[model samples]
Target chain A: AQSVAQPEDQVNVAEGNPLTVKCTYSVSGNPYLFWYVQYPNRGLQFLLKYITGDNLVKGSYGFEAEFNKSQTSFHLKKPSALVSDSALYFCAVRVGGFQKLVFGTGTRLLVSP
Target chain B: SQTIHQWPATLVQPVGSPLSLECTVEGTSNPNLYWYRQAAGRGLQLLFYSVGIGQISSEVPQNLSASRPQDRQFILSSKKLLLSDSGFYLCAWSVRGVAGGQETQYFGPGTRLLVL
Candidate 1:
């Protein structure tokens, strides 16, 4: 089955510290991975995506993700996290070229000061 | 630039009440429209998608129904609302097979439904 997995249910990070939210995938063909963040009572906002090419992809708000083909992972990362960065993050993936993204359970990030 | 709009930013309806949530896309033509629901802590669950006028595809089995009355307008309807239908409903759009796998779906602000 094609699915995305976020290993951690919640990630705790100190303000100004680097943060990482892990994600792994099980699919048939090349995976189109995407990351989305949701604030309280709001819709999801696009963060970054990994299609092909570069392994390290940068997204909005100084966030970046590394795509590891061998591990079938696309983990979201940020050099430094802010207290305002606390939100829920989701990892999504689709088949070779399907636009329908199957999302992971999601991981909540708590950046405390 | 394309934008999607969903109405009734928040709603509080009683169980068994009818529902009508609308979404419209501007600056795009023949786009793919989708309705997704997210529970308190659950990820998005795709409920319906429409490719064109009068064309609708359901992703899950539910009491809700969808219709594409026009090219850019999609409506989600339920004859009777259930407590299970309470959640954050989001409307999104993507260019139809335009960029292959790189297709990005833009979402609306979303409607928070509370059924009692």
Candidate 2:
């Protein structure tokens, strides 16, 4: 079985400040990781994914995530925060060759102007 | 290009009432379809998936059931609605990728269900 963990329930940041949403995963063999964002009453939008090659993966909306195999972590990072960026973010993982994804509990991001 | 759509953006029903939610995909053929539920303030839970027409895989055992009657259509149904079933239902589709590769899942706008 595969699983994902997001340690933070909510993260607060000021506009123009850097932000980080933490994620970790446990799975057998290689892992395929993904990041998604959801606004209130809206469907989730894909941010990025990590399959292989280049530990640093760049995603939409000026966000990026670094995959650390040693720690089994894929942390989402942004150079600066925007009020519009405040939303719920989820991290998910799947084992190689599996089509199903196991998602984290989700972290709500709040950016104060 | 591909698009997924779910009908009845919001539904309110009494307990013990029948439930039905429809989802359809356009511009894609033989796509893998999935049904997921998200409770308030929680992550998504995979309820069912279909690899092809008439082939449904259930992840959780509940009153809710899913059927893929057409290549591009999937349906979620319940014989009797339960309060526990109240949640935001999402439909998604993905291309079947090769071994060791990852496929991106595209989601629908979702249907919010409330059981009274």
Docking class of 1: medium
Task: Rate residue A17 of model 2 by lDDT.
Answer: 100
User: In candidate 2, how many Å is residue B10 off?
Assistant: 0.2
* True interface contacts reproduced, per candidate: 0.64, 0.62
Compared with the true structure, what per-residue lDDT tens digits does model 2 show for residues B1-116?
Answer: 78899999999999999999999999989998999999985789999999899999999999999999999999999999999999999999988655664888889999999999
Model 1: per-residue Cα lDDT at residue A88 = 94
The 10-residue segment with the lowest total lDDT in model 2 chain B: B95-104
TM-score of each: 0.96, 0.98
- TM-score of decoy 1: 0.96
Model 1 segments more than 4 A misplaced: none
- lDDT of each residue in A1-113, candidate 2, tens digit only: 78999999999999999999999999988999999999999888999999999999999999999999999999999999999999999999998775588899999999999
Q: Candidate 1: lDDT of A78?
A: 96
